[model samples]
Target: SGVSCEFEENPCDSEPCLNGGECKGSQEFLHCECSTGYTGERCETKIDSCEPMPCYILGTESCEGESLSYHCKCLPGWEGNGIY
Candidate 1:
């Protein structure tokens, strides 16, 4: 005689997983697995994917995508990679 099931809370704590998604719950269903570059439905959006947009000559330099590999930073003052 010990049965009590009442689950109607803890849905990512209202965080909604955006920009840096990381919400995972299991009561009925609730998912949000976005982070690197971000996505839609909850992770928001900011996808660069580094698909032909790895800062070659735009605004100095800028390309970020930490998941498959991507790194380039050199804008103010200019330096390496930015191609003087």
Candidate 2:
């Protein structure tokens, strides 16, 4: 006796993705969900920390995060850090 395997193409049943995501087949009847700034169906968005933020004030080029938000640290002589 011989054993054989058969594979079927099953599309996603329910689309539970956000931010322009696509529905693809996964292990179960669920999709791999993808989100903005990410590719593939598994919602693997890459966060680039080097990106510039508008909260930075003059003389300051970057900002740092505290707990739940971020704050700008202006250089010497600068007025505001733009983060308050």
Candidate 3:
């Protein structure tokens, strides 16, 4: 009897990785290595750094963490950018 070999398709060929994420593994296994400030299976989500609130002043500063960068802003009636 003769043996036959089957060809497997690479998952990365579809360009599964997003947001500059790197695709890894073979047909048996596939995953996305997301870049900075990115998450999810296909790296489709942008991590929010302000979610935990990095501002030093409680209720006095506004934290804006969009993707890879973060900034703190003082609320009204307050002074300084709150970056320190």
Candidate 4:
């Protein structure tokens, strides 16, 4: 006689990973691989590069921050890329 077994549900079926995180594993367990600029157990936290403020003269108000880098806004009368 052949034996029959019940099917097991995958833990990742619910898609627990958040914020562009990739889920890996199977019915046993799952983990999240967060994308750039994001961190935390579920990738919910966005890394702020401007916390320390790298801009000089113009201060943090004119500081443009990204995931891993920052740019300073040009002073008044200055032209080119600082307008944005």
**What is the lDDT, from 0 to 100, of the residue 34 in candidate 1?**
92
- Residue-by-residue lDDT tens digits, candidate 2, 1-84: 124546543555445555567776654566655554555445555443334464644577567754335666677777573564
Regions of model 4 farther than 4 Å from truth:
1-5, 52-62, 73-84
Question: Candidates sorted by lDDT, descending order?
Answer: 3, 4, 1, 2
lDDT of 1 by residue, 29-81 (tens): 78999977678778887765566666666454676655456766768776665
Clashing pairs in 2: 32-41
Can you write out model 3's per-residue Cα lDDT over 12-84, one digit (the tens) per residue? 9899999999999797899999998899999999899887777766545578777766788877776765553
Q: Report the lDDT of model 2 for residue 53.
A: 64
Q: How accurate is candidate 3 locally (lDDT)?
A: 0.81
Kindly list the per-residue Cα lDDT of model 4 for residues 17-82, writing each as its tens digit: 888899887777788899999888888888877667655554323777788877767677654443
Q: After superposition, how far is residue 3 of candidate 1 from its true place, in Å?
A: 12
C-alpha RMSD by candidate, in order: 8.6, 7.6, 3.8, 5.4
Q: What are the clashing pairs of model 3?
A: none
lDDT at position 76, candidate 1: 76
Q: By TM-score, highest first, what's the ranking?
A: 3, 4, 2, 1
* Best model number under TM-score: 3
Worst lDDT run of 10 residues, candidate 2, spans 1-10
